[model samples]
Target: MRRWASVVAALALALPGPAAAQDPIAVPSPILTIDQDRLFEETRLGQHSTREIDAAAEALTDENRRIEEDLRAEEISLTERRGSMSAEEFAGLADAFDAKVQAIRAEQDAKARALASRQEEARQAFFVEVAEILSEIVREEGAVVILDRRDVFLSADRIDITDQAIARINAAGRQTPAAPAPATPAPDPVPDPVPPPADQ
Candidate 1:
């Protein structure tokens, strides 16, 4: 195994780098990019949704705090009464308190999950409406495809249409039509893909 390892190492060092093996493809001209995250964070619709979500989260926090205070008070009261009550009666009350705490925790957890789902729904709705604006920009630019900026390794700033999309979305105001479900694309196989060389 040691002899084979040395031979493999020698062969790897003799191989040429990727650049020497193949020429790099020039950036495609008809491809445009947009910052999907920026589209969600900067648009008026996004801001509106964010404000509502934040308010709801704060309210949830307040409710949790109040519940905790109430529970703590009940616990102290129960402790004080433990001395006066019969042992069996005190045990029953303590068991009920524990069950109530567990039930409250489960209810609060469900509420938190519902809040998260609401946030996701808002994001999906924003994208559905913004897709129309993006399509218009693509048509105007005569671009073949709109890629998420994060997916592209290198591209000219001129190809980015995020700002344009945001402006159009905000300008559309409250009169914008109701959003439909997002279109899902069919998957296709890549042709002759070259795997990157592994490190020695």
Candidate 2:
């Protein structure tokens, strides 16, 4: 009987305690959903890039107009000179005109490449800012995992923090003033007109 009682006590001690009465494998629902687009649009860096891109586009337009005008003027001059020139001279002028056109095209191509590179760089910087904000949100919400709204099939409105994220991102971005635009050098001062010599 003593041996039986000792065996029973040992068995009871080995069994799970009261703390183990509850389920150990409870699955948690996601706490929040994020809309990456909204976050990107609302970010401070995004706004800055938008403004910069607009300015770049406007400048490009002006550059294009200048190029077009130069081409048109060259064409007009070539036409007028062709009427007075020998065939050889006209051919040389045509070749020169072609060279000028090619040069202008190359310049335009360079400008386009530069613009694309700058835009890409700006986008990368904007995304980095978004990533930092998302990290902060994750910590604050105690979320085990955050899903992009685009990826989820369905999520309750309560679980969506996209609007809140945008607000935070915008607020953080607005705290710092945008960097000043680089100054364009002023055009060289017009030379003073010399007085015509008195007629003899």
Candidate 3:
């Protein structure tokens, strides 16, 4: 009877009785990659950003030109009449022109800074939406990691999500706020025109 029981146990072992059904090991998926440069150039948000930058530059150029033209006219007038004017009067005119030039420079710089700030704000909003979409993609593809395409040396184009990212960006339609008007700071105090040397 004991021999019979031993034989039965041996048969059970050989028959594949559930001996520690090990939990299926979880394996990490392959890393996914994105062509960020392409996304930036081709995406709707990117194109919008480019347009905003271009518009800002054009506006700045127009303002600079207007200021320059005015200054040029004043300079020409000063140059043409310098011979007849008193030394004091000419010096005063020159000083005024210099002050105008400085003011224009400050204004233009402020405008540029405001435009840049708006652009950055838009870019940050775009990336936030991008991250949300990427989370979905990660689950869909079972990707363990996401890396910039620039960093990756070799990868199947199948892993490239640039087009999809661009599409989602367009769909998101994240609105960029218009640039804020630059605050008018108090003008710098004009220095007193230096008195011409007594001998001159």
Candidate 4:
């Protein structure tokens, strides 16, 4: 074994460097590249999440449109009545309407923000599960480094693991749990009232 090792070592050294050998004894970088965007687009969980987000956005838009139309009609009606009302009464009504519109806008904005937060949380939870799948694949492949395809200009097709990851993720489970809701902290228990000292 030692003699064979020596012969092999001599042969490798004799074969000029990369410039000459071309690849008589080349060692690959063992870097894995993945198309993350493709993975997300193709994965079942990702697709479902996207659909949910789109539906939520559409619902909000429709609700907003309805509110806007109602407000518009009210504005037109108020304009028609302006001439008949006392100035103070008209001013009060206008102020109230403005406040109501502002409140509606604020409420819609909050709902939109909440939906966005939920979608983001759901995705965050998904990636956590995906990371495990990726780690397992990486180890199996003997990869020293894993890279997102977006950062790479080019890579051998053999190094692409996006499809494998998607498969493994799907096989692991079809039911991707939604991100857990934020916990509401329990109110502090009221301190028991000290027993009233016996009247002396």
Q: Which candidate is the best by TM-score?
A: 4
lDDT (0-100) at residue 92 of candidate 1? 73
Off by over 4 Å in 2: 1-37, 140-160, 174-200
- Pitting candidate 1 against candidate 3, the one with the higher TM-score is 1
In model 1, the clashing pairs are none
Residue-level error in angstroms, candidate 2, position 81 = 2.4
How far residue 143's Cα lies from its native spot in candidate 2, in Å, is 4.6
Name the lDDT value of residue 116 in candidate 4. 78
Report the CA-based lDDT of candidate 3 relative to the real structure: 0.70
Error of 4 at 49 (Å): 2.8
TM-score for each candidate, following the candidate numbering: 0.67, 0.61, 0.66, 0.68
Put down candidate 2 lDDT per residue, 1-200, tens digits, no spaces: 99988987887785445666354524333467887766656666577676777688789889999979978987887789777867766776677677667766776666766677776666666666567777777777677677878887644555678888878777775433233343344433333223234346
| lDDT, candidate 1, 1-200, per-residue tens | 99988987777675445665475434434888999889888888888777778888899999999999988998898899889867767777787788778777877787787788777887777887777788888888878899998898655566788898889988987333223223444334222212234335
Off by over 4 Å in 1: 1-28, 175-200
In order, the Cα lDDT scores of the candidates are 0.75, 0.67, 0.70, 0.74
Clashing pairs for model 2 are none
Ten-residue region with minimum lDDT total, candidate 3: 16-25
Ranking by lDDT: 1, 4, 3, 2
Per-residue error (Å), model 2, residue 120:
1.2
lDDT of candidate 3 over 86-166, digit per residue (tens): 888788778877876787688678777877777666566666657877788788877877899889755545567777877
